[model samples]
Target chain A: MVNKSISEINNRIKDGSVNVVTAEEMVGIVAELGAQGAAREVDVVTTGTFGAMCSSGVFLNFGHAEPPIKMQKVWLNDVEAYTGVAAVDAYIGATQVSETLGMEYGGAHVIEDLIRGNTIDVHAISPGTDCYPRKILDTTLDINDLNQAIMLNPRNAYQKYNAATNSTSQKLYTYMGSLMPNYGNVTYSGAGVLSPLSNDPEYRTIGTGTRIFLGGTQGYIVGQGTQHSSKSGFGTLMLQGDLKEMDAEFVRASTFTGYGVSLYVGMGIPIPILDEKVALATAVSDADIITQVMDYGIPTRDRPVVRGVTYEELRSGSIEIKGREVTTSSLSSFKRSRQIAGILKDWISHGEFFLSQPAERLPSDTVSKPMKQTRGTAMVRDIMAKDVMTIHKNASVFDAAKMIMDVSFNHLPVVTENNILVGIITAWDISKAVAQNTFDLVENIMTRKVITATDTEQVTIAARRLEQHGVSAMPVVDEQHHVIGIITSDDISMLFARRN
Target chain B: MKIRIIINRDIVTKPILAEAIIETGIPLNIAQAHFDSTTGEIIADIEDTEYRMIKNALVSRGAEVLRLDTPINWDEEECVECGGCISVCPTKVFSMDEEWNLKVDTTKCIQCGTCIEMCPHDALSLDV
Candidate 1:
């Protein structure tokens, strides 16, 4: 049974009667303390949402066996009777538990309330779960006993977290199904892990596990065609060059089209770059053009011309000119004029017909150029520093500050024995802790929440992640939560220079 | 020499008529009226030969040709008080009889078969 109220919890913290714990061992320690009436509220902070889910599962399953009260809303004195079970199973069964316990499962809101109410006597935070844990714990706990727990199964940590927090039911089931390795092995799969669905094209797999069948087609225009004409009355002109040349031309054309379309369509619609041009006319001898016009009894413009029109307007018959109907024949003629103008422009610029131009030779016989490399590439391994300095949850803030200065490092990766990244402690955190005069414990000064990257990721991705999150540095970790290296803005700057 | 080829054949076969509504404005039922198989000439009630190119393109891609006919025009006065044209038109070209006996919203009409089939008064007939 819980004995202390919100005010009494604060009083215990003020008098130094209660000590904050951040380790798995603190689970039993705080439970015992709570039972002994050391303080009514025992705040449990985990590393992240995943850590919170896993720890909450363990606390609810194991701590509830002793009937430990899990604090919900500290201000409202709302408490839920917990049951001890594995974090994964507990998270999966959270909805059922909420329904059975008649409690509102408001995700991280419940955790937030517990911290604000100062009911949390101990916080067991997992490193990569929530966005902020250090701030929450520092405000509530004694900050000295904040120990990190390295869990054996981090995938289970993620699965349990996602299952409890994600809103989509189908996504939850898909995640659970993915966890099944074989029979009942219960292997956990990470998020965004891809797997083959089915071989049959008739029933195609769409989004992850979702599948849809191929349907039959119907229409008058079954296939599309390119419309081109020759002004020389020959009907055939070199419309497209060799594949490579055509591809290069297409790239340039696409760039122009993208810019033009973006200007016309605005930034919202992503317009695809088109390679093929709508040829309105082919190059014709001046004599043939005059003869053809006379033979066809058609009116001729002063300048010899051919036309081209976009395929979209042709199919839809939706193009209009100043509130007047543009017939296909008229459009074809107009396109011819534009094509002629384009060809004339190209000819005038190059001093030759664009179609008849010879390809330029490559400088393959020339000596290979020497490349200038940056510091990051010159000393890739040295730039990747290892054995990063860290501080324990229970270490004194003064000691943590001394260690930071001693190691000549600004940031430290907080982790447990099993090598799970728990949190990050920075010089700034220590400074804040010193300013607040809470330097007595590491938990009080050390940042309990941290942004981290995986070791397998590229430094560019790491840099982008840092930029996106507005962080100066990040701890690189392995799947087992072991800190491998620390990435900083300096390293990223070198990487950017090398790339450019 | 400009050779005028008359194709008296169905532009779209029955099997693929449903898709014709979305891909081409010509309805599956109406596509049959535009072609003349005997003369081998298509007197298509299309606005012009652009539709002919579209039909030829479709046929070249394995769509079977059947018959062709001129498109139908609706008599505004004789059109029944029923609003079947409004509901049946795929493009929603027709509306309720307000100022006139029957109003045709020509802009929205895509020449699908629904409005022609649903009209009970037989007031609507081929324009060409």
Candidate 2:
């Protein structure tokens, strides 16, 4: 029943008598001595994670211009910044893409550029008001010119996250990186044993106002992040720090091929060992933590979980998926994570860093929810044409073409006598059949692998599938694979048109 | 030493690299090789002393060989030693040293170019 307070730990740190070790090192210490023994021996356990945190941004107060214009809209280095706050204050989100430079440059790039001491071009437009008369301003400013540059991230330092793999046959570009076709590779992003929240999984030591290392400087955990779900083992932190004091080495900007830009943030937290329970929690290892490998091919919010895997299996460079071995790549940097933890431990041991009692403990029972869309919430069944005419697989190509032309439809579903969908034949397929001089059964020319929509599926998902497969329409099928209806690009466009 | 050999359309059918390896008695680790009907390109690692010998043998066989000085450029100054490139690289071009610092063995780089895209710092690029 060893008990110690943060004040006691700070006193030890001040006297240069505190025994500080990284979470990775604490694992061995706890294993050597029991948790109770280790709690008496160790004072603080440092943890770290360096990965692409897309929900990061900064609040900048560019001092008032000479003419004093109220900035209604602002662009920092061509990347848009939300400027609805004050006269010259704006919050630059990390994921905002550049208008002129496109995905090549973004808000993350602008932040990194500022941290690197590079000058940024600031352009703003304002509808002139009585008090503030200036209309437009274009200027270049460095990080030094800003009255306050604060890095206030909404979500960061995820305790654990799902590993991503593609089950589809197409190369899927996602925030998880380029997932190869047919589960060719897997990518997981987290620092496994070295993660900050993983060390304090219960949010016992990490919460509001907990002192932390943010981008190589001292920072604080503001509160739980936007999607913090500690109950599901994927807790997140909201952090705040002085951006002007941040080191460029710890802040970086990255661009995913099709997904746009993100910011890689380096974050560290020191967990003071108050008791044996705290010691045991801080000693958690890669093998102890479990996370699901999600199939990223599914674009829906609730992606199917492929399998449960331990971080030990992930960090080993490979994991088995459906009995086949797939090499694993980590988007998070473990090497840098270890360095960050080591640096935090050094700072604590040298008395440069101190632990603090959190102002409020993070909720352990929180569960995240999907965003509710206010518009475009229609289901596929609502807009799909009902009782669509179908051609039999045994029918000739000419019959399919005649059915498509007569019904004024570009695609016709080939079905069995029981109305079970077998394939789909487009007018283009019939034309290609005629050009090749081969007029045979509709099954021979029909596309065997047909993209389909379900009655219960959201229209947005069906639309995405059509666009992904490069098709203008899809057969709406049921659980029995019966062609119940058909939905086309025209039907979707018409729905939006009616809504407007 | 790493070198990229470009076999012309006429000599692509012949085993120029295999013959060069045999002539110089140096083993070649071919990291990446692409072949078509008209042209062949190979990037391989060889001993430093045998580079000139292999280049001369390859050039005699109507192949253009160039030392690979800048195929994949890793900017050390900008890199924070993140291990983002380690697992994505098929040929194991990146690894961690004793201090958990990133180490790059460019000889094994197959130029898959995934690492360049995966790097968060934009610290990696292909010169070609």
TM-score on alpha carbons, each prediction: 0.24, 0.85
Which candidate gets the maximum lDDT versus the true structure?
A: 2
Each candidate's iRMS in angstroms? 26.3, 2.2
Instruction: Please write out the lDDT profile of model 2 over residues A1-500, one tens digit for every residue.
Output: 99999999999999999999999999999999999999999999999888899999999999888778999999999999999898999999999999998988999999999999999999999999988889999999899999999999999999999999999988778898878888878888898889899998888788899999999999999999989998898899899999999997788988887889999999999999999999999989999989999999988788999999999998786898888988887788788898899999999999999899999999999999988878758999999999698999999998888898899888899899999999999999999999999999999999999999999998988988888789998999999999999999999999889988
The TM-score obtained for chain B by all candidates, in the order given, is 0.41, 0.74
Write down the DockQ of candidate 1: 0.01
Candidate with top TM-score is: 2
- In model 2, what lDDT does residue A174 have? 85
Question: Residue by residue across A475-494, what tens digits does model 1's lDDT show?
Answer: 87777778888878787787
Off by over 4 Å in 1: A1-382, A497-500, B1-128
